[model samples]
Target: MLTPTVVSNSTVRRSSRTPAANARTSTRCSNCAMRHLCMPQGLTVDELPKLEALICNARSVRRGDFVYRAGDPFENLFVARSGSLKTVMAHRDGREQVTALRLAGDPLGLDGISTGMHTASAVALEDSSVCIIPYPALKHMCRETGAMQDRLHRLMSEQIIRESSQMMVLGSLSADERVAAFLLDVSERNGQRGYSHAEFNLRMTREDMGSYLGMTLETVSRTLSRFQKRGLIDAQGKLIRIIDLESLRRL
Candidate 1:
């Protein structure tokens, strides 16, 4: 029912992952730019190398690649190193809904922890890479290390908070307001990653955005067009420039 936990923009995100999963050493947690957004956020210098060793390696994903499908065994926790991902929940009738749009540094595959089976599937939105954190190792680290344990708890709390916020966006906001909210969400996420707050490209498609916002594709396009005409935003295809951040926020 909720869109997802936005991982947002990442720094040092491109540097990060793997050896045990047949992945080579691409980057380590101690040196990753996106470490702030993932498990390495609170670990001390001495603790970083220990955490890094828990990851066997990184994996490469092309656009449209499935990171994991629903019902897959929950084994590893994935962190996006580059590019973006979307977590989707499919229905019985072959329809699916976008549950989350994951940016660089977002952790994927955590939902499987409760049942030991993935509740949703993840797909890469672009040419991307992910650090595959071995679950057993991660759990061991959590038990033995206070920093890892605290970060794990914090990440879980973050997931709850984001879902709650998305519920509010869906429950009370008007169509225009919803679109405004969506834009603001993306902008804020980008800013958090140290990217330009006022300008960025949208990775999700119009249909995807509509699905996430619970609006029609036409409504999503129309609302964006209206925003452009009103000087609230300037859009050329997927690239967007927020011209009136205050007004958008006020909505």
Candidate 2:
């Protein structure tokens, strides 16, 4: 019942103030830049159109907008078609935690699958766009397509692995080690997306980083300064450059 705008590739660059119901596009999944990451593999030429037909819509989310709030109905799974997003969970006592950072090519809304409602809120980190895959339709397709079913299973398994790794980072790593691993993880993800892994802009603020890394804001700032002094990194405001990759890894 959620009625976001159906956008094509050309319709994605509208003003941030544009209402979601006002825009439209004809872009197809076959031509999407993120197909390599979001699409199932080994589909025949004839089968490609069926997937494209199901994924004809996308929605743009302006920075700081909530893509979907916690407790919202789980109607669609989203792939980050462009830009970044962060998933956050709110405590009953009013505290919030950054649960995960999602970049382009990453999937969102899986958290809702278990309960038929979202457990956390997804917010855009920048002016981002998401390709919407209606879950009921996708579930139906998966029932008929072996490749699609396999891809869905693999995506779910990868989410489990990521959650396990986050637990490991929080439970065992020191503050310095935690920060190092965070940077390395971001670098690797950027590399995977064909960007320069050695340097990239961090869209999140220091406080958000602290929330995600389980460090105090002061501690996060101090650690970054220490890394700069040690020649482990060069950070200018939001831009970060990993100067000593091997040394950072050794941490």
Candidate 3:
């Protein structure tokens, strides 16, 4: 189970990578690269150790494997430690929609909080790894101090902001406008994670992108071709280079 069950000091607090059997390990929050973008961002140095004690290391998830499924019990929140994953929601008519794409350093499983069960399913888009944050342990930890409590609220606020942005994309944008915005958004987010903003590969398929943007796959293709003809972007297979970010934003 990815859900947290905080063991006593005699358990996970032992020296790491020991030769003994039954050894359990946790990552240090102070040393995490994503600490500033994650729930532990505001934790002080003194409080970092406490936060570290709450996270449990996890094994890698293979491509096409599911991290969790809709209707499953919500025990933990998942962080994309490496690679990427997609969240899917199934329609009553049996169609599935890709709700979101999660990259390294991104958080997942937040939608499970409302009903204590997951509302969407997460599948690894590539071989991936996740940090499992035990929800029970996290909630208990939040109650122990003020900083983490505020951090929890901030995390939720960010989620709300992301949801709002997604809503705007779906409700207001035209097909070409949607693709333009999607590329720019992904590029900006990728840059934040230390990748090249203007040049990168598209991890999501055209079909997935169309699903996210509420456009048909053919529409996505035509729009890209149009963007290419206009010199707004250069697409060679899955790789894309935005030649005119200003034009894209204007679109």
lDDT of 1 by residue, 33-138 (tens): 7877886355677888787767655667778777788877777788888888888999899888888889998888889889998899898887788877767778
> Over the stretch 131-238, how does candidate 2's per-residue lDDT look in tens digits?
877788899999988999999999999889998999999999999999999999999999988889999999988999999999999999999999999999999999
Q: Report the number of backbone clashes for model 2.
A: 1
When summed lDDT is taken over every stretch of 10 residues in candidate 2, the lowest stretch is 4-13
For every candidate, C-alpha RMSD to the true structure in Å:
6.1, 5.2, 5.3
Indicate the worst ten consecutive residues by lDDT in candidate 1. Answer: 4-13
Superior candidate under TM-score, 1 versus 3? 1
Q: For each candidate, what is the lDDT?
A: 0.80, 0.84, 0.80
The parts of candidate 3 lying over 4 Å away from their true place are: 1-25
Identify the runs in model 1 with alpha carbons over 4 angstroms from their true place. Answer: 1-23
- Candidate 3 lDDT over 1-251, as tens digits, reads 24322221222224334445225455655666666667555567677787777787644677777888887778788788778888899999999899888888888888888999889988887777777777888899889878888877877898789879999989998888899989998899889888899998887889998888899999999999999999999999889999999999999
Q: What is the number of residue pairs that collide in model 1? A: 12
The number of the candidate with the highest TM-score is 2
Model 2 local distance difference test score: 0.84
